[model samples]
Target: MQKLHKLLRMGDLAAFVGIVDDGGFAEAARRRGMSASTLSRSVTRLEEQLKVTLLRRTTRSIEITSEGAAVLAEAREILNRSETLKEIATSGQAPAGPLRVNAPVPFVLHVLAPRLAEFHANYPAIQLSIDMTDTLVDLIGSHADVAIRLGRLQDSEMLHRPIGRTAWKLVAAPDYLDRKGWPEALADLARLEQVRFAAPDHINTLRFIGMADPLEIPASVTANNGEAVRQLVLRGLGVARFSDFMIADDIRAGRLVELFSGQLDAEPLEISALYLTRVSGLRRLGVFLDWLDAIQVG
Candidate 1:
């Protein structure tokens, strides 16, 4: 055990990582300006220490074994943490670390996609890892730095900062309306073919403004992705309630027509940036939240 402990040193692990990253011993050695024989030996030592075969080698090419692939993932995380630690120590004023974010698919597709370049330009030092999904995730349990959520949130220990809201737009393709006829009221929505977005967390519900009760309707088709739902809507498949931001271009282009504008305001789709209580104190989180708060959702 002690021998194994001595062999799994940071330097040896780093050397092992380089081998996998560069794809082969000779290439990694060339990049690092080290002897190929030295790197090969380091990997050999790592394999022995772990008591697993990490590589399959012949005269010409080598492939990583299953065990090697597993270790490679862990090694990369270690290296990333090491890099973050070094950056944090050297650059105190600049927020430099991996910022893992989770956000709804609709927001990611319509809102965040266009402004990512600007965000990167502003925070070039901070590494962003954005996970797009509609399903609700535990921010603390998932080790995510921030989660951009829409609609109401259940009481939780995480800190929430209001960012923006999504204004719901009831819309359909012009062709669809011509074929199925325009929905004059919320009651008419049920008669038209509906493009449904079903996810574990998203309720099959739409609440309009000035309506006493939310409309409950069954959908003709279901889709998991917001982009897919938009496409489905554009194809004249059915009428679907969409965030105004997602359909703004279509509406302006005369491709889609908004219906029931005077009849309903969607139950507030409040957008907020949720983060762990512990992470709220971190400057990296603060920097990201500040940026989020400044976002003007069009």
Candidate 2:
């Protein structure tokens, strides 16, 4: 047991992580700047020391057995904690590691991208990697430090902080309104041409205001992407529901006009930043969260 304990050191933990990340011994060895034979021997030694077969290896490929997967997960957690300790000991000021973030596509390009330069300038030692997608990502599984989510959060395990609110507006281009007239009531929405915002499987619902109840408008044009729906609206195809932040520029330029504004509710969609509560107070994560709060969006 003592020999096994000594063998399962930091280097073995790193090797276990590399195998899971790279998907094979050859790939993991390549990433670690070692030969494939060397990596295989190291893993074999680890299994022997533990007296457990952790991986199922064949001539063509290697797969982590159930035991191996559990071990790998524990190893990753240990490595992360160890690295955090090292950072705490070495760096006394500012964040100085990779910050992985996930955010909705439009928000990243339209909102976060513009402010990144300033963040980079302030924390020059920190490196930022952003994954932009509207799809919901598992923060722990993806190793993401932060995520910017729109609307209400359903994950009770996560820590959520409200950043801002986005109003949902029913808008139409001038030409479309000129042709189809205007929708005066909830019933009018059914009669008018509509463009549906089709989000991915998990995020495929739309909410509206007024009429003593919510209305679910059928789609004349259904798209999986928000940008696609926006383009169709720009072309004067139909009236669509969009976030206020998204159509702010068009409304200001008079390209799009809001319909039935008086009937709509004032509670805008709540936007929040989400992360694992345990890691929310980390130095690097806090720095980025503070930067996000300072941003002013209309």
The local lDDT score (0 to 100) that residue 19 gets in candidate 1 is: 73
lDDT of each: 0.75, 0.74
Q: Write the per-residue lDDT of candidate 1 for residues 1-298, one digit (tens) a residue.
A: 2233344777777888777666678887896799989888888888887999988987766798888888877775665565556655765567766788999777887788888898889888789888887777776434467888877778655678888776778788989888877776678887787788766324346677767777766576888877788899899888878777789888999998888775555554788888753343466777778887777764
- The C-alpha stretches of model 1 lying farther than 4 A from their native spots are 1-92, 183-191, 200-218, 277-280
Candidate 2 displacement at residue 167 in angstroms: 2.1
Q: For candidate 1, what is the total of clashing residue pairs?
A: 2
lDDT of 2: 0.74
Q: After superposition, how far is residue 182 of candidate 1 from its true place, in Å?
A: 3.2
lDDT of 1: 0.75
